[model samples]
Target: MTQGAATPLPTPKERRRLRESRSLTQAQVATKVGVTRETVRSWESGRTTPRGRKAEAYARLLSQLAEPAESAEPAEPAELAESTAPVEPSGPAGTTGPTEPAEPELVGAGAPARTPARKNRRAPSPARPARRRTPRREPAPSERPGTPPEAFDALYAHCAPYLVRQTYLLTGRRALARESVERAFQLAWERWPEVAVDPDPAGWVRAAAYEYAMSPWHRLRRAHRVPEAPPADPEDRKLLDALLSLPPAYRRTLLLYDGVGLNLPETAAETEASTPAAANRVLHAREAVAEQLPGLAVPEQLHQRLTELAGSEKLDAPRSTTVRSGGEKRTRFWTRAAIAVTVLIVGATALTVRVAPTKYEPVPAPGAPISGVPPLTGPQHMTEHDRKLRQRLRAELSGGPQRLAPVAE
Candidate 1:
């Protein structure tokens, strides 16, 4: 097929369909195409387009795989095909190598095509299209203009139960998990305008729930202070313990990638981390879990174990109506608190103005001693000169008076 000009590559959806129709896994395709499974995933997701020599090689490989898939009768559902397909051997972490630009993949290059088994199943005809699964329900009506409170309840009811279980894995405390899921829904309700228009509303709520559940502050809460009881089964207990033992980031990455079955890029996007960092976290988390439960060394087993543990717990979400009411109550409480604070500030200012002095009053000056004045003393201590002057005055008066008296006689 590579000898002639390569057939034009199919659309992303077609590429994925062609691969699945051949019962070929992404890892198998990646192995055959000399690229990482993530690169193949990106190609199918239409995030990036392959180019250069790799593109031609990928095209030829897909064309080869397509020949068999196109001619073969529809044997089984895609899920069943995947289930029956042989598992690829796990490789070392470095097997994927450094991340490459996203590219397409070739499926079933060396693998045998699956043959149809059921006699009752009808072969798809050219006139009639093959049966397809029903598309998932959308939240289109939930975001209509002036949507009712029930719209939020619908969104909550759809996401809350599963999210609670997911958060429980993040934080081992059941109470904290329930609270986290409820709080996340409340936030979503508060930000409905934005969340309603979001591409992935469920993801928005999930991220919020994960953040709140993994918060360090939850440790301070009395209810979350003591650890929750471990799962009854030894295997479930070990798995939960292993999950809780991982760093929050690692655990979240592992759950998103393995448990939730999100691709690496999607997991990275949800976790708000780089792809390589997210991959690293998954590796470390898997290693940690494997240490405790060697049976779960394979990712598929880990995913199954996670599902079982979550299902085993009775971590039911609160009613959506109750959550909406709680959110509304919280909003009202804060609003009233803010208004009261503003009124208090304004009233205090007005009272201060009314009681304040109308004019400035100067303070009185302090008294000080007067200088340059004689000191008061007693007259008993007269000077000798003062006595002499008084005696002379008396002598002169006595002599003059005696002469005048004789002349008159």
Candidate 2:
């Protein structure tokens, strides 16, 4: 009977708006409910209504999106009818009742044709407008007043070793690991207000390290230009070195998942990647490193060591210097220049001594030779001789002797 049929549902626009408010795309909702995007689209567009379990699921999803309706409002039959409206196209044309073709008998065959059923099945409820759920707000800046400098120092002390270990895993060099970890903390200190608020401070520091490692200037300063091949232990020093050699994104992905012990979802959140993308990054990073260092296996001991290191308090110490904008380049240039100058000075001094003529005494002034002095047998070793020799030798010698002459009798 007509009374047994399901009621019509809301127009599609309402569903779309509700989903949009929850920050879900049609595809996302469809995926959650085991339906196609087109089906969701159709539902939202009001072209059709969902039925049975599908309709129930849509209602559930909508319920999740909205806060529970206030209990203060008592449920009424008319209100119930409005709330149970068909979410999909299951009802008869323009009719607000159930989809059953024939009117069912209530109170025996003698009862009037329009009589209601046993009331066990409630009337189809209408679609109420979805309510918005307010997101929990973070503490106001005024309330937080920022973390104290002491807190930063404490955090640094706790976090430093972990950071160093992560840096080592990425760079595989102790010096670079120290440098990267130190620099990361320095930067963190400078931006403590923001960094401290991050859900995972270690993760943030690791990300910063990856950025530092990937920089062009950092690469150029590497003592070992080519990445050191991975060691037999994937968590070994060599493995860490190889990882540091990888592209920043890959390194970040791997460290977050494998090194940091973050699950796929957590890794996705930390790296700002989708679940699938994060999974792919982890897989590829592992494969890439493995390819280069085939002998190295993922060592449980190394993982434990890194985890222990990360958990230690001493590892958190903040470094004195922060990474300045364009600072790496400037520092590299000056360092290289200093090394070059030192090398040139050393080279020049060696050449001047090697190529310059040996000084000789002037026959002991033909009379009284200075006490303890051995008489010179050759040309006078006067200042003038030295000057002249230097000038002549300048062009001929090109500074230093390439090969020394043997001692003569």
**Model 1 agreement with the true structure over 159-242: per-residue lDDT tens digits:** 777778777777887888888888998899899877776545677788788888877886777876666788899888888888
In model 2, where is the ten-residue run with the lowest total lDDT? 105-114
Whole-model alpha-carbon lDDT for candidate 2? 0.54
Specify the poorest-scoring 10-residue window by lDDT in model 1.
103-112
Q: Any runs in candidate 2 off by more than 4 Å, and if so which?
A: 1-147, 222-238, 241-247, 288-409
Q: In angstroms, how far off is 297's CA in candidate 2?
A: 6.9
Among the numbered candidates, top TM-score falls to: 1
- The local lDDT score (0 to 100) that residue 250 gets in candidate 1 is 91
All candidates: CA RMSD (Å): 15.8, 27.3
Residue 67 shift from truth in candidate 1, angstroms: 26
| Backbone N/Cα/C clashes per model | 0, 37
Best by lDDT: 1
User: Which residue pairs of candidate 1 clash?
Assistant: none
